[model samples]
Target chain A: MSEPEKALAARSLASCHDCALVVRLPAGRAHVAARCPRCGAKVHRRKVDSLARTWALVITAAMLYVPANIYPVMTVTSLGKSQSDTIMSGAIYLLQHGMWPLALVVFVASVLVPLLKLAALSGLLISVQRGSSWRPRDRTRLYRITEVVGPWSMVDIYVVTILMALVSLGQLASIEAGLGAVFFAGVVILTLLAAESFDPRLIWDRAEASHARS
Target chain B: MPEADGREHASPAVADAVIEERSRLSIVWVIPIVAVLVGTWLAYRAFTERGPLVTITFESAAGLEAGKTKVKYKDVEIGAVEQIDLSADLSGVVVQARLGREATRYLTENTRFWVVRAQVSAGRVSGLSTLFSGAYIGIDPSTEGRPQRHFQGLPVAPVVTSDVPGRLFTLRAKAGGSLEVGSPVYYRSADVGDVVASELDESGNHVTVKVFLRAPHDQRVRKNTRFWNVSGIDLRLSPEGLELDTVSLTSLLIGGAAFDTPKDQDPGGPVEEGAVFELYPNRRAMLQPKLTVKRPFLLHFEGSVGGLVDGAPVEFRGIQVGEVRNVRLEFDADTNKLRIPVLIELQPERIALNSGGAVVSIGMDEVRRNWDDLVARGMRAQLQSGNLLTGQLAIGLDFHPDAPPAKINWDAPIPELPTIPSPIEELKTGLSQFVKRLSEVPLEQVGNNLNKTLEQLERTLASANALIAPDSEAGSELRRLLRDLADAAQSIRLLADHLEQHPEDLIRGKGAE
Candidate 1:
């Protein structure tokens, strides 16, 4: 094996020690499958297609979001009469009725939180690609936040669902779910997948290697 | 030892590697995407859900719930309560409502809003008429005006007294009994309108009540409409019988307002807004001239005058023209006189019914010019009892064209009205005077005259007696002849005895043999 390969194998073996796997270095820089020598188990490495798959899913979700907002998310009918309202209108209605705090919470959960998570995840991804050596702790915290907040982005959608279900008044009044709900659901799922597909090991590897050199 | 050291070194690296990994996805794009969806949805809703916004101000917002109340037209829901807010002054609650897009066409500047609840009345009327119906805003649309933002609260319920439209007037009174907002209003004896609302004014001294009267009937209400509280039975002794006068059976139980337009005047201009009227009692004793006429003239009177009483209405012709002022008695120059003089003032307009005269002209072109002559020729003032059973007197004037004119001495007699004594009083005085004249005849002088008459009768009686008495004869002169005379006397006596015994024999002369 070449000296660099030996060093890489040694690092991989050391990292896998807790799992009962000792990696063996190959001679050249070509990709090779390594197994833990101590436990005779195959070591799993980050997938080569992970980032692309996540990017595809997130971009698809992003595209769907446009139509979701542009169309009404719910249709309400009362006594043979039909009407529709969107998120902003609903919030404003609540505010006008002296439900300000509730309105604020809904606004943040449905709009601001989702957007923040998206931006943060994107930033983390870009930094990871450029091999940035910035504050690793902060980036880790940011990732954690994105993952945690991703599911909550469905708050508006859930609210719509519940309202549509509860407010069905037969002929007197009724509520129907709309296209915006589907799009919002897509955003949540895609964001969650994006967060999951990210590889944290890559961050520590670079960080530790630089620390060793220093 | 070397492997252990390497493992420790790589552990830190593994942790760092995990942090460094990132997804290739550009998640930032999701924000705009979601925003666009929400925004588009909202815009569509805004375009489709069109409605008019109306703001109503309320003094108290005790039971109002935002997003719950609704605006209704003809009991059909047209919109919903969007929100509620405090007025800038914090003195009231301002409610904002949003009607459906189609409903916007119906909203106009005349729309009204009010709170409704159950009300109780002392007249034994109770219950919730509008319960389960919920509080609703009402609209009265005007075709000409644009939609307005601010609206006045019409807290009063719609009055449905009559079908015609007319100006509404309000009145206030100290309700002797309980009264309700929807009480009926009567004019003369006809039902004209109803009470719309009753509320205490700021001063709280009186309760202002709103009443509505319908069209042609409302026109009957003139400036001189006299309002009286006619809610109870009024007992009046009319000439016919004991009269029970009441507006209505229900009004007698509860209470209501009654007014009348004077017969003479063309119904005065429509009742002015916010006009206040006094409430007169239904009793005849309370029938005094309205304040408009009280200030001008004051007159006094005395005696048992025939034509006037407390309620004896003064009349110009046969029509009632004025009223009696007072009735009293006075003593002048040690002579007691029953005096009753009436103070009569004519209603200038009613006086126009009489003929025109230089001194009493009423500017009526249609009036006959010789009014004084007509009055002198046709009018006769007399005392007429209201009801014989009740003994209430009323002065009546009648046209007595054929009857001789009253001997009213303009120059010699007292200027006051002659005291016409009541029949009972006249009978009593005549009887007493007859007794006095009889008692004045001298009984003692009559007794003396009777004694003189008796003495003269006795003297005449004595003279007659002396003539009838027996007398002495020439006696003893002829004693010698006594024997012969005796013999003759004896013979005569025998004959006299014989004649007395037989009168028929004497006429025949048989005793002389």
Candidate 2:
């Protein structure tokens, strides 16, 4: 295995996020606020309060996931008969009706994807919060996966919107969005922000701090 | 050297970075708080908006889909059927349904549920729209009575819903006939209501028909109103003539009832809802004068009482005053004879005491005294032919001054009245006596004497024929004499003929020709 590289904080150097200008930081205090001389921008050694912000968003998204799966996402009325379907129930209904392929797609995109993303984000948060230096490489990979797949959970909300807009033929046949759609949308958007606000470099900072202490 | 110079130049311009402390709580925490508030609110609303689940037991689940059927009241949906299961006993299906939150207040014991389907009956056609829209459960909600979640569904839709403004009346009849749910109730040739139910009374002796009369028309019913079955054509062959009566063609097809207060009597007081009225079979029977007080009397007859029956009229001077209770044959042990005792009940109301032609109420003691006095004055009960064609008999009370004196048997259960033989009975007795006298003659001896006389007459005729034979000497003389007489008769006839002509000719003077 290659030798682990030394961190930039150990070299007493911090780069400006806006202008990429390297500046010498005041040593021995990583919490100090600094300004870049080249672009007049506030700079930090890591995203400002990355753990707390991502934790707040992830907690919110996790809270919203409950109602998203509990309540009905949409109600479809056709030929004087009406039916309401939640995400999991819609998948089950499709599967029962001999359309396993469509069921698989819906299950993976709407239910499984959001659930896995929350788990990955929460795992990354706990490991970073605990200051564990174990497998920092895999933790970064998990963060990337959560970021890339977080938006796909919005597939259910889009289906609901398109069906509601297109199927509004008065009383004969109509589609209506339910409260679940709002909560589900919140989960999708919050998870995306949680992934965005997460600092992957924090994964290495913990390892570097542990290594220097040892 | 370039890095060392740059660091020496940058070190002079670079200042220490400023550090500041901020609030521990981040504003991003608001997202989760808003989510908690919204999620809690959504859950609370969902919990509150859900209504109670009710189970209804029905005879069958026909036209009922597990989740498709909706329960509606007055055309507005109030609930939906959620699931269906077979009853434990397997006699019926139990339907579980979820009702709207507001429907909780009206789920009472009297709330009715029935399946609504297209129906065509004799008097009504309903729910035609259900044919295309499919069948659905119907509800007639009632807020009265105890709240109940379990219910027994009705097999058929009710004839009268509670929303209709009406009053109910009960009619007791001998038979149900064609009266059924939805049968019309008529007033003065117009349909005013419908028969809601026709059920047999618990005793099974008669039918109890419940009718609903619409408002305004319902007020027309009075205490003294007479209700009669106007079903089918009423053809009566009465003493007046052949009579035909009917209310309407609709009533003629489907059974119906009609009510009216007689013109001569008062309409009486307004009746309360569910007032019971006796249903008469016909208008004539309903119009019979109502009598409150009756006194029964028995009359023993020695002659046959063949035509007399229960309900036979008892008359006083050709006017009906009572009806026969029954005609019975009894063995009179005291007299050692079989006698027919006819029981009749007299209505005291029909008899008016004339004090200068004014009716006065007579007490029983006064009536007994008067009756005794009348019997002493030769009042007699006799059997009379009421209808010659029908051979129906009636009891006639009339004065018979020559009748032997008799007394009323007041010791009997029903006071016995004295009776005299009817005129027809006397005529029958006379004809039977005449037949007895005619039968006494010896008809066979008379026929034998007549036969002997005829044989003697035949022998005399044969002897006379032999004496007058054509070949005998006496016969020849008689023939010659007969010829001479013929010649004289011919000459006389010619002379008379000539004289007759000459007499007319002489008067006209033959010399003038």
Candidate 3:
């Protein structure tokens, strides 16, 4: 759902999905297409198939996660010798070399943060599917958190890109991204899309339905 | 209660839609499936690349541990110790190591494994860099040998490698002396190989050393090649000059062996592997064809043979014929005389003789036949000082013209050859005899002759004096004549004085010459 339509759902008023303008739908027995006067954009009460789209994107991101960690993100050649390390191993190499602070940062962004976002998204999906209202406020807060943190997972991808660009000393030392980097970046981008396609109004919709039933 | 947003009131048909109809299998599920498949492949690749396991038995696992110690081939780790277990006999440690797949081809029966660490032996210092890099099991692979998975660890590093292109030979010496494993073996004073192994012989009477001569050096080892221990400094001080011989400074520190095929003699042919050669004590000893056939003969010397020891050279006309085999003191109860029995070995080959233009040697029969004649001709053995400073004496055979008459005891068990006193002893005795003969000379008879001659001379002198006496008639006449002679001497003296006073007077006839 767009921002304007999301706030309009609780008050029984039709608001533009793109802009915050409220609009009245013409009375009709057939299909009615509501258009906002101010923004001239199609206004819907909720995003079309919001749950399915978000679920598909989230699943795709989860799928790509495997390859991202399995393959080496880039190869580093130094002094005519080339060495390739995976993300986990790269962090380990840094730690072994006594750069543990950088290793910790990499670990959190590449491993822990991504895994937590997936879990939080899964939890939110499950709660909405079951029509449960348990800790609805906290669940909404968690959704916001997952959205804000989703882009930061791309830090590892950025670091790899920068290293690839900067470390080009030809045979002396050159770093080129590997297959893992592609999959990992795909995961980050897909997760961001999944967060965007999710309709937050669905969270309130399930709680109200459960409250009315009780 | 149902329409919270109030934006849409769905038809009953739409509201009654089944959840399964609304939910559809997404296309994105294919990604997870592909991810699962690729992940499995990567895991399998990692698993298949690990190679076969082999067990190495070592006397002790010093600096070795399970999963930590590496099995390295040329300083690159090819495997690691996976488990350490006690041998069946519990006498040593057996380590199981998993080699990488890349090392499979090198697993051969003849491949050697040894622990490399800092080793300081009398022969050399090696593998010192391993001290910092940590100890590792070294692999020396042989490509031609049959494949094997089990190996026995070497106790020490192999000094001679198979790839070094060398031939192995056995050398027997009375003792190990200072030559050790890794001790350099020299050919013509150039280091060629090393003593690979040393062990006591089964009889324990001698030490058998296994030596390697690498490549072209192996070609240098002829059947007639001579090897000797050149461990310590060899110093010789002689009347001609001083000579010092050493192979190298390392040879002095660790004790090494050197070999050479003498230039003068034929080297015969290249020796085969496992050929047994004798290691002589020094260069001088090695140069001589090792005298294997020795004829023993006993000699009885009358004087002390204190300086004559076994191994002392026995020379015939200043040429070494053999060595003093044994020396003993015997008290002859029958003769009540001290007899010194000396046993010497004579090598007939060492006594060279010239026939026509070529050098020939006399046979043993000829020596025996001619021996009796030589004894009759005053040929005897004597002790001569070979080196006065060291008090070393050698048995010298020569014709002592003044030696006491004696016959060779051909009937004796040992074929005893009579010995004459040494020249020093002979000189001492001859001086003493000369002194005794002088003491027997008659001093009284000589004194009587001298007194008679003196009395006769005195009587003659008295008669002669009476003729000139002034009291007798003949004496007075003689006196008058003597006075006339004195008057003439006085006139001559006066004339010499007048001449001295005036040269013109003599020239003018001393007034009337």
Candidate 4:
């Protein structure tokens, strides 16, 4: 094996004596007999299924993003009357009230954050798949942002829930949850999952391989 | 060394195991999923629950705003304003509102919509809705059929007095400042109606007014209803003092309306649409100066005498009922006529009643009737005065049984009672007249008779003087007689002495011898 492979193999198959599990280097390669599956006892190589499992989750998250935007999430009724306002409409309503800053916050947290996170995660996944030679620093920064902003994307969902719970007027008026809620929830969950499943080590692996060639 | 390395590896493995155990559950996805679910539910609720849209128009939008103002019924909010835009003509504002489905049924064609706010007045009920929501649209529901789109503006306030059904009569009077529209028409001092409208006639001579009464009272206003203006205070004077009659304090503060219905004949004719009735102002008679004497001057006379004093009737022509108003001696300068001017007020109505005259009569006819009565009754004028308490007077008419029938010269002054002479002036005149009569008597002849009588008296005195004169012949005879008398006297004295001596000196003859 080349010197870099040797180093990679050693680092990828580190052993945990207590659990008999293998603490592998963060990479896409598969290995057998790496650890005891039941006890996580130390072994010789890392599990080969980690990369595939992560990629599958990212794919599932991508599929849910479409329906989330198209459907409405809340339905409001007053005095035997009903109307549906989408995310954009609600933001516009707030904006018209001279609450532009608040509207911008809602827009960013609910819409822009979720979409950006999804796109960034997808890009990271694709780059990892291609083994692209990219700046480690840029990639780390992107990853940090995704982690920090991922939680805030649920702001729209939280706001909707809180409003629905608070504005329930028994017979005179009421607000009901719509189909869009479920789809939006799906999008949030899937995007979080996609972010979690991304492999940062893939970037390092490409760097190391390029370094060897140099 | 092998054992030490094994231990070191074991330590690392133990630490790694502990870390893995601590991080068993990755809750990040759960949090986002839950949040997304809630957000989705709320979004669904927002879209499906809106209401209907409606619009209202107002002459001036004023304080109304798109989303702030609400349509209210009995203070319950029924709708919210959606948008406010000026109409194309710019004469008014078109307000778009969102009516809750439940509240839409309340909007009807005849429903009245008006803006409500605070108002100030001296005697008004105001600021009723300020305690609730600020300014709002007040809706008054109507019983008309189906709901319609258009709405009518309601008057800001209710009318203080309304005329729906009542007796309509016109009051004709010389228009004065006191007689005005909205003046109280009082019946027995109670408010019954008000002057609704007033207008001047085309000739500018008369002001016609329309009055309205409320409720069952309207039925009481008959065609012949007498309408009078109650503009000033009604006063009655008595020994006690002056009494003022007016409505209650509240009515006094706001003024009042009044009217009365007569009991006897149903003066009720068809409601005369524009009947101009007589307006007898309480002060009209007092305000008017005596201009032209239409009828004989109304003299109010009064007198107090013993019960048996003359209670004779004052006869114009002697129909029998005009009573004496008063009897006072008047010295007339024009004719130098000393006569009693008896003040008398005759009730033409009573005369008309006895004669059964119509409501209105021509001046010529009335004058002719009076003339005929004057000729037959032997025209005599008298005075009359009303009761002290009432201040009403009527002239009585009666026959002058003692005096011959006197012809009445219409233009000449009516004959009055002879004025009794004042004692002082009568005595002075009598004395002057007696002196003049004495002067006219034949005193010259009386003076001659007096002369003859003086002569006879002088002769008698002369005879008397001769009989007793001392220097005359009678005086000489007297002297001789005196001598004889002296001698006789001496002899008689001696005899009387001898007789006294002789107890009964015989008889007085002896003395004489």
The residue-by-residue lDDT of candidate 4 on A121-185, one tens digit each, is 77776776676777766987898899888887787788778879988997567787776676777
Question: Which candidate should be chosen as best, given lDDT against the real structure?
Answer: 2
Model 3, span B1-513: residue lDDT tens: 345334354222111111112224555556556656776777798689979898899999887777567888766879888999999999999989999998888889988888887898765678786665456788887877889999999988888767688899999998787888888998767889899888998999999998998888788888888889898787765321355878888888887888888888898976788899988877867877756678788988766676677878888888888888999888989999887789998886786555676855568678777988998898888888777776778888888777788887777778887787788878878987998897787778878998999999999999888876768888888888899999999999998898888888756765564
Give, for candidate 4 chain A, the lowest lDDT window spanning 10 residues: A25-34
Docking class of 3: incorrect
Each model's fraction of native contacts: 0.00, 0.39, 0.10, 0.00
Ranking by lDDT: 2, 3, 1, 4
Segments in model 1 whose C-alpha atoms lie over 4 Å from true places: A1-214, B1-34, B40-58, B64-112, B122-181, B185-242, B245-310, B313-339, B344-380, B397-419, B422-425, B431-513
Task: Assess candidate 3 and give its lDDT.
Answer: 0.79
Candidate 4 yields a Cα-based lDDT of 0.58
Kindly report which residue stretches of model 3 are placed more than 4 angstroms away from their true locations once superposed: A1-134, A143-214, B1-25, B57-69, B82-95, B118-132, B144-146, B236-243, B331-337, B352-370, B388-391, B400-405, B410-413, B434-513
What DockQ score does model 4 reach against the true complex? 0.04
The deviation in Å at residue B340 for candidate 1 is 3.8
Best by DockQ: 2
What's model 1's overall lDDT? 0.61
**Per-residue C-alpha lDDT of model 2 across residues A38-111, encoded as one tens digit per residue:** 78788677787788889989999899889888888988877556677888999999999999999999999998
Residues A1-214 of candidate 1: C-alpha lDDT, one tens digit per residue: 4454445655543334447443433323223444555554444455434455455556656666565565667777776445565666666777899999998987787767767777787777677676666898889988888888788878788878898889988877888987767767777787788788777665665675566556
lDDT for residue A53 in candidate 3, whole number 0-100: 68
Chain A of candidate 4 compared with the true chain A, TM-score: 0.82
Candidate whose TM-score is highest: 2
